[model samples]
Target: MAATLPIIDLQELQQSSSSSGKLREACEHWGCFRLINHGVPVSLMSEMKKVVGELFDLPIPVKRRNVDVLSGSGYIALSSMNPLYEAFGLYDIGSTAAVHEFCDQLGASPHHRETILKYAEATHGVAMTVAAKMAESSGVLASDGAGLFEDWACQFRINKYHFRPETVGSAGVQIHTDSGFLTVLQEDETVGGLEVMDPSDSGYIPVDPVPGTFLMNLGDLATVWSNGKLRNVKHRVECKEAAVRISIATFMLGPPRYTVVEPPAAFVDGGRPRLYRPISYEEFRVMRQITDKQAGEALELLQGPAQPLSTKFDVNSLPADVLAQIQDID
Candidate 1:
């Protein structure tokens, strides 16, 4: 049987200790979970979905007006690279000013802009809540009980799958792990085409949409931050039917673009060795793009080289005090 995607209740998470364990396990084993009762308003969600559909329906020239503050951050059209997928991205979901700029860039109407801003606010809430849960599971207390993950930048993407009868059974987007920390996704309620590769490397599991809930996927940065503990879920889309699919993904991309993305000191210890060299989000993203490593394997290139074990150690060869004295030989 295929593995089942974990379903976590946000309300239950706040009231029970078992949910905490499930959250940790989801991060370590599955790297993704369905989140329900997450507090994002249902009406706002509906409005956002309608607006997303409208945005994608715009003419190609109008859609292309969604430029980026950074290349690869803006309008992505259906092309050979991803023939069945087209999307628009926003650089900083945490910034109200940035949200306005994104609306202006796309000529979003008053209602659309209103819905987008409200959705952005809700997305930030969900991201912060999940980030806190992650740190709690790792025994890292936010200095002020919160705000550690608040400063992180989030990038929002609205994706459209142009599925056709002829494209059924064909891939819409190739398999890949998200490049950020965690992604909060609002999937199409009527379609089912998303599938996540099993962490055990056995097979893929279809992720069916659950109404009034959001989907969360821990990503490559999650693996780095967790010292290789998190699974860094890899997933892809296929055209299962001839219906169009629309989804909104808000990625908690970690600290600002230029800031170093590193594992916490707590993650480095006697048994859990640090896994990767420090690299900024932008740098790692650029490296992956330049190298054409959009798949899960890209992380291997960033891994810290293995250290040679000391094979000559013999406890009997050292005096009682020699272990402390041997540190300065080099």
Candidate 2:
């Protein structure tokens, strides 16, 4: 029998401990789940899909104007690495200025611009809510979880896969793990091409399309933050047929550049050792790029002898400009 992702009811998550437990279980085991009742209206979702399709149809010159705010955070045209894939990205979708800038760059009409902003807000809400739950499930206090994400930036990517008859059975996207904390994805409603690596046997499990649901997945930052307790799933998209596919993803990228990513005190204890060292998000991202370990293997390079739990950087000791940046972020 084929493996299927666990279905997590967002509504039940708040009302039942069992649902919460299942969520944690899914995080530890599957690192992914199909989320329902996530509060994003069905009508808005449909409209968002239409908007994404239109955005992709924009002329190449206009799409090229959507430049990168961060590395790979802007227009990603079809390349040999992902021949079937192209994308438009926003460094921080939560920023009104950034959203409007992207809209202007893409020449989005008034209606499409409104839809994009609405979709961004809705998906970002779900991302934050799910991230808080994940942190709580990992034993971090509610206050701490809120603090961890309150100021974090959520990057956005609207992807398009131009699958052709010759590309069927080939990979649309290479298998890899997400580098962020969590991802909230609105996948194509009719296409069935996403697949995740089954941790139990290291085989692939088809992630079929299921309308009215969002797919949530844990990522590399999650594993480090949970002290290796949470799994960072590896997944890919395949060319299932000669049809276009679209997926909108919101990535809860790790802490601000000035802050380092380390497990909370709850994750580090006498029984559970801290597996990774404190590293700023930018440093870690650079290391991953330098080493070309995009599939989560760079985490192993970060593994070191455990340090005293009290070992930490002092905020007051930071350079004035860095501190100013941190203040602005918060």
Candidate 3:
């Protein structure tokens, strides 16, 4: 048996901003919270679930052939088995070619494209709202001198976990933090495997599936953006009773790395000025992904006359048209 996770109401918090203090504390302690009565429409949620189920139910061979690790698109089947369960992963949705191929393989209608885009946009709006509130609670600015998460990028993924009834074991994801700033998850009502590690209690707490609500959790980039003010991501999924679990996650990435991330003046003291080296989000992400850890070792390298990373995104590779389209995404 696992300890019960806490549930929070976003409306209550909005009505009384002071309640955000408690929410912030919960995030710091548990690294996760469930948000009830969030603004997303129920119908949209239903359509997303229906389409995802239809897509995943396609033949196994069709799904397997679509996997592309290098291109960062398509279905990935159980490549990473968490300590307690088996799961699939997907990422990078902007690849039009891959999306078309996937839809064709599933024999899904062309309307699925509209459905996916609508879902993504709605999720993005919700993510922005939550991020703004979170930034306000954590005392961080959204780069536009606003309290909300402006200039944020959103990515959505669906996870399906299968279990065998007689196995009598856990079957889900391992304990790990997300790579983005924030994660909003809508899980199936029947299955329950999501768990968050309580830092203080040294025990695992179960986050039961709740209908009409979304679960919010911080990620590694969020911790960095908040300059350690917010909680670090620490959650895992476990399968019990051999029941399958399906979850949809929306990852809200923080402002571009070029935006400076430093502690607010209110939190900084005379002796404790800014500590982190200023780098764009893109640079940080790329460097973090690189196998060579030493590639980003020179902190003072930026202060000197050396060329900045921003210069690397050359005009030839990323034309003005491309940059304009990327800007329009937010």
Q: How high is the CA lDDT of each candidate model?
A: 0.77, 0.80, 0.59
What candidate 1 gets wrong by more than 4 Å, as runs, is 80-82, 144-146, 305-330
Q: Is candidate 1 or candidate 2 better by lDDT?
A: 2
lDDT of 3 by residue, 197-282 (tens): 77667677777777878888876566555555566556766667676667788777556435645445534557645445455545
Per-model TM-score on C-alpha atoms = 0.87, 0.90, 0.72
Candidate 2 residue-wise lDDT, 1-330, digit = tens: 887899999988877666778889999999999999999999999999998888888888889899753554677777665478788888888788889998998888999999989988898889888888777766788666656787788888888888999999888777888878888888899987889989889999989888889998888888988889899999888788999888888888877764778888888889988788877665665556556687789799778774422324344454543322220000
In model 2, the runs with Cα more than 4 Å from the true position are 79-82, 305-330
**Clashing pairs for predicted structure model 1, backbone only:** none
Residue 161's lDDT within candidate 3 is 71
In model 3, the Cα lDDT at residue 4 comes to 56
How far is each candidate from the true structure, as Cα RMSD in Å? 12.3, 6.1, 7.3
In model 3, the number of clashes is 10
Colliding pairs, model 2: none
Clashing residue pairs, candidate 3? Answer: 84-170, 84-171, 85-171, 85-172, 132-148, 171-239, 257-280, 257-281, 258-280, 258-281
